[model samples]
Target: MEEVSTKPSGYKEYVAGLLAGVATVIVGHPFDTVKVKLQKHSTEVEGIKYRNGLHCTVRILATERVRRLYKGATSSFIGVAFESSLVFGIYSHTKNGPQPQVIIPSAAFGGAIISFVLCPSELVKHACNKAELLQCRMQVQGADLIVTGMFPGGSTALLRESVGNAVFFSLNTDSSDPHNLTDVGIGILTGGLGGVAFWSAVLPLDVAKTVIQTAPDKSCQRNPFQIYRRTGVRGCYAGLGPTIVRAFPANAAAIVTWKLAMKLLGIKNE
Candidate 1:
């Protein structure tokens, strides 16, 4: 039997993680804008209303002279780098075990486990985005306001990935041997399926998070359940379409980047 190495190639993994992070940000950014807008739409400060997703885009373009809807893109770039690094690191480690008898399921287990780090990011990103938006509004109108609020958007993000991975991995099966095109294909498929499952599961929570973050009613005490109840099922999942569309490609990029890194580093066991 080949000796099972505890430590795989760290440098390669790190490089792969970085590359994947950059790619995921680029691929997911547009959809992310749509998702954030949809989620944050109902939020209004006093009588000042931030428009819906389309209007938000138009306003940002027309008023702010920025075609990009997102204000703090640097936050996303850095966050994605960190998040993807952790995710890919964990994934490569878990996937190195004697080819999982049930490959995708094991992969999903790995994916869900990484949610711990990602969840906090979700919370911080939404908070920061809202804060920035509020700042922009106040600055534009020259109003005096101090905005401080915390929402547990990250909690559901972690939950979403955890649950989504569980569902996808449970359904996955693998027949490919090592170092084969078939193996790569299986990996890609596994990642794509896992991404879909993960995003779908979290769609509702994502919607709620957007609403809470952008809403100026910081004094209003409402829970996630309340947000869902207010929005109804459809409202809670308003941005599902865009999310699902982006997830597949983003996940595929991650998987491919990992494989390429592994190969380039000559870290193959075979």
Candidate 2:
């Protein structure tokens, strides 16, 4: 709990983080909605619901239109806002030294902290609960949805967060000279590629997380490796396309908001 406190960075960093969260939500929710849908539904009903991310987007637009893309935004807004604030607040406090050794572990710690928050938010975003999760949506007519049910796949989430964030924040090593436009250009290039690396590494875990949380069959194995065996490599990478497309702009907006908020708060970038 103390890890989430905004005491470090004079409480301003957390405020900046909240702004960044809103920015991320605004820029990323549609992609996330698609990702969640694909993770949960792509393999259902003979795997014909969505051919790919673009096809999924088109089908949603064609049938349910634009609003469909933002299906879970309301719950997402609260969950992501709080989760982002905690992550950035924790990161700012820990990201003091610019060395890879320092930044990576610190970012990993922040990621570990956020996983607890992310798991439950994931449950809500996917309309999954212990009871609801054990029953298909069609069976939810009178099935009790236990909001307080078991938090599924917590360890898997921890793995994804720690590994993904280590890669995500390591791209910002501070030793580089800003005067060298070439270094900055290289930074941009590596950052984009590294972002892809981060997603590619963890997205399978994410797909597993969704299954553990929302699988309608109670007998479906809760283990991620077992889930992987069932889902296969391609199945687990279900939402990679939209996620890659959204990663660039959405995270850019988050960084922009974080920097702008810090500036407005009269804090120096560390």
Candidate 3:
């Protein structure tokens, strides 16, 4: 078992989180492409029909080849990098309070905080989603407001993130005591489960967020409930298949990378 020699406290979480975000984007972007496709068009009666995540993956590979699946990868990489760093950093930082007690609340607080961050990044990512290949999503946290109109799906983002983070952190692990998690394997399992819980809880909100953010026209209906009424219950979970599948590996890889990065940086998870 590899042990992290240096247990320095302060900036390590953000650094480790940075690495974790990179891993997440690399491992999960293809699935995410499938997910976004499904979210955007799965409910449609006429158009490219993606029966499921696998079908979508196959179709994209067949038509556009692998590159098509990673169309927005560049922008996704940058946005996810900042979003993920803040996710772990803020959540972990707030978790400094009494263990177990503050875990979920801290996660929610962190989620709420980063909701502001992710809204614009996500907007840019999705706004240019169907546009030219690999649009520059380098709009940092602050510049996003003016660059992208006032966040289109701000409320939905907040709901998904706050609730999602609470569920994700709660299931992540009982890691308050290091002894509880035997090793990295356990951490990976718990972390993956956490990710699953997060998506499962908030996927509907995600579907709404995607639709709202990617709306071509502002006059288009913005209400999630209205969408649900129009599309029905099944439509709300349009991309559930890909999201569930991506949840495990993407987040498992993230947790493992986070731990490994911490080891390399001479620190430990907060």
How far is 134's C-alpha from truth in model 1 (Å)? 5.9
* Model 3 lDDT per residue over 1-270, tens place: 666543336777788788889999898899878887877776755668788778888988998999998886987788887788888877766675435678888888889989998887777666565653223222333455475565878988998999998888777644333333466777778778888989888988888888887765567688888878888878888867667899998988787777677667655454
Q: In model 2, which runs have C-alpha deviations exceeding 4 angstroms?
A: 1-7, 33-72, 128-148, 174-194, 217-219
What is the per-residue lDDT of model 1 for residues 1-270, given as tens digits with 9 covering 90 to 100? 454334666666666677778777776676677566656566775554656556656655676665475555777778777767765555555664444454445455555656665654554554565677556545643433322233234455555665565555443333233357777777778767767877787677666666654555445433678887777888888867767877887776666655566565555522
Deviation in Å, model 3, residue 229 alpha carbon: 3.6
Error of 1 at 111 (Å): 6.0
RMSD of 3: 6.0
> All candidates' TM-scores?
0.61, 0.72, 0.74
Worst 10 residues of 3 by lDDT: 132-141
Give the TM-score (vs. native) of candidate 2.
Answer: 0.72
Predicted candidate 2, C-alpha RMSD: 6.6
Instruction: Give, for candidate 1, the lowest lDDT window spanning 10 residues.
Output: 143-152
Of the pair 2 and 3, which is ahead by TM-score? 3
Top-TM-score structure, candidate number: 3
Encode model 2's per-residue lDDT on 1-270: one tens digit a residue: 112232355678788888878987898888887776777676756545776778878878988999888876887678778887888778888876667888889889999999988886777656743545445643643334454344667899999999998888776544333336664455455545556777988999999888877766456587888878887989999868877888876676666666567656655555
Candidate scoring better on lDDT of 2 and 3: 3
